[model samples]
Target: MSTSPDRVGVPASDGSDTVIDVAGLHMRYGPYEAVRGIDLHITRGEVFAFLGPNGAGKTTTAEILEGYRRRSGGQVTVLGEDPEHADASWRARIGVVLQETEPERDLTAEECLQLYAGYYPAPRDVHQTLALVGLAEQANVTATRLSGGQRRRLDVALALIGDPELLFLDEPTTGFDPSARRAAWDMVSGLRSLGVTVFLTTHYMDEAEYLADRVAVITQGRIVAEGPPGTLAGREHAPAEIAFTMPADTTVDDLPDPVRAAVAESTSGRVLVHAESTLHILGPLIRWAEGRHVDLPDLEVHRSSLEDVYLALTNPDAHTV
Candidate 1:
């Protein structure tokens, strides 16, 4: 869909409604360019994740898009307005959950949300916001008394006080335990269910896999790959890995043909199979083992995960090891 008349719409390359349109974005710190000509289009109501190693300029690009930093060059339109020039109304429409914050130590959770809600013209109910963020039980608790995860939830609740149309979550689950991280994931999923667009910067691949509709990999100030979490770097369709413990009697040299084409290795009590399709070789491997009265132990099948693809695409040199 097209944006405001003067601001031309980015033609949807992947058939998605554009919420953030950026082209040739650049940011520099003195003589050193942190971001060099990056282009990305975040679709409406979709979770877009930005992944990169340290010093890859992911943060710089995200800051420019969030209006926290000025871009040295290139076109940036967030929700159809230049983020750098957008006013309070524009700011009100966006929610941001930063990495860290030290709010007033004395304020209660309810009071905190209530205070921030006053700034927005149409804010969500404080009590409801508190419950939505799983902080209802801590409503009356002092900010300093809350745990790190609870404090992070409070940050999210404050960001949602404005009932924003777009949300920016940067390393939201940084210190969260597994359950807390799952809770945060559910909250993000809930926001998307309400049609809130999300721009996320995270190091957690599993979190990205669970929440992101699409992921972008940035390295040395450039987007090397961008697509659905599963499909990035063509890994969505990459082969699966099958591994099982073979009986002590079966040796590598005794394995059958055609099936042998998919076997990556076989030694002692273990066997590893790499195949384009799991169905093609799984049954054969089982039957072959059974026919020989081989007792297979701990059979497992694994596909190329987002983490694997991320490492492969971002640091090709490291994969050599």
Candidate 2:
């Protein structure tokens, strides 16, 4: 799909609320393919996270959407225009926060924002942008003097100065301390409240879980799973693990038949049970324990985490690609 520069503010023709659309996208370098026919979409005013390990097609796919690298084959539309041929007006409607930046050492934060604001037809107030990014107190500080977290915030301020409708954030909080990362997350959440669509790429699992409305996992140039972080790869329905300390005199063979069926691992005093329904296994085990007047010590139940699902989906044995 193609949109003219004059149609900069127009909605998509398909009547869908999508801000980004990619179908059968692929990228190639010489004979090696970096992206292999991946299809995905991002809706308006939602935070969408793209996740993958190193050497996956995450970077290639993001670069294509950002208009940095042309795809080898696919159909892509960003804000109703083909990114490869989008014009300056189309560019103005989008903002990008790269993984790192190097601003002029001598420029103050306020001065830096002012300079970038001049490039857009309508820019946000410099002071307001600084405050939004928690850099209001550091407005006069030189770029070189700012701390790592402050510099990262400045990058976000620069991206927002143009009042963009769509924001692309590539690892926005890579080196942040825990507190700083949470602060950055708040800023991204604020952007969503202002009706800005965010396309995020990050390696942090918790970050994706906290900030994304939906997540897509890509591996070897193809998407292996896509859904809400909680349910990705059917994680919500995956088995729950029940672990407890067995009594000193207890043996695996002595346990009830139902309990034995659920047992997955056992050590000297510890037993691990994998069950689809905790109540099914716990009921029988509890009855046996109560009848004997013994305690089920240190019992704990845990469902699969996003990280667990991710590792499973991206397992090296899944496919050669």
Candidate 3:
């Protein structure tokens, strides 16, 4: 639980700005193309999230970037070296956390970390790595005795033991409860503050919204949209909706002409107005209610959420509005 700025065994900054760069990337399994000509660039010390539904080629793309799989074509540079031909030193600079791991059941948490630490020429102190991932209190607990969330934290500790410049996390909070998920998010944010570039893959839209500096959404083996979570697929520009429960004895016909013009639909005694300018519609609606000495109940304004935009981008057949 220490937020100390000093991280042991961290490599000196090499002055490289770009952490990951991919151009015209493609991957094919036999005749089926899983990834088709996608391009992305991730900067140093930034959190980048890749989102997609199952079998959307997101996993395939991530594996290629991690050097676990070979690309069919295109150029990839991770940490200023091609992952395909990078040397041991290049591998030392990158860390990968798989979706699931089965650590030795009998080994204590600290023991597991110490085991992995020996793999690197310069490894972080086992105790410090435990604290960095919020696992210091559980250091002496056996791996099998720990909870699911605790085990996930151990996975991260193992990944960080090498003091990697770049870390790849695949669904780091898969089975976590709400509180645990928030803790994991805080850990990731701490990693970013320490100048580690994170390449994240997760199906959770809210996680991407909260953690990623930029996001790329993949569907049907291609990138459909790429931008900040707030603006991806123009979610920021999508129409705003003003909704309110109709006061008793106030029929749709009783609504003012300007208010009625903005009405998109109504259901269960509630009226929804869709407009680009929410205030323009809300102002008149409020004045109309005031003149009638009636209050508009349960008034609410809403914009497209990140989940809304993500679903629309991943599923073209789905309606956005």
Candidate numbers sorted by lDDT from highest down: 3, 2, 1
Best by lDDT: 3
After superposition, which runs of candidate 1 have C-alpha atoms over 4 Å from their true positions? 1-16, 290-295
Query: Can you write out model 2's per-residue Cα lDDT over 221-271, one digit (the tens) per residue?
Result: 889999999999888888899898887687888789988988999988799
Candidate 3, residue 42: the lDDT equals: 92
Please write out the lDDT profile of model 1 over residues 191-290, one tens digit for every residue.
8767889998887889889999998988888889999987888885788888877667666667767467888887775879888888888877777888
Q: Candidate 3 lDDT (Cα, whole model)? A: 0.88
lDDT of each: 0.83, 0.86, 0.88
Q: Is candidate 2 or candidate 3 better by TM-score?
A: 3
Query: Whole-model lDDT for model 1 versus the true structure?
Result: 0.83
Candidate 3 lDDT over residue span 1-321, tens digit each: 222344334345678798999999999999999999999999988899999888898778888988889899999998887888877777778888998778777899998987777767777889999999999999999988889888898999998988898999998998889999999999998997778899999999999999999999998889999999989988888889888989998887788888899888988789999978877888888899999999976999999899999988888789877
Poorest lDDT segment (10 consecutive residues) of candidate 1: 1-10
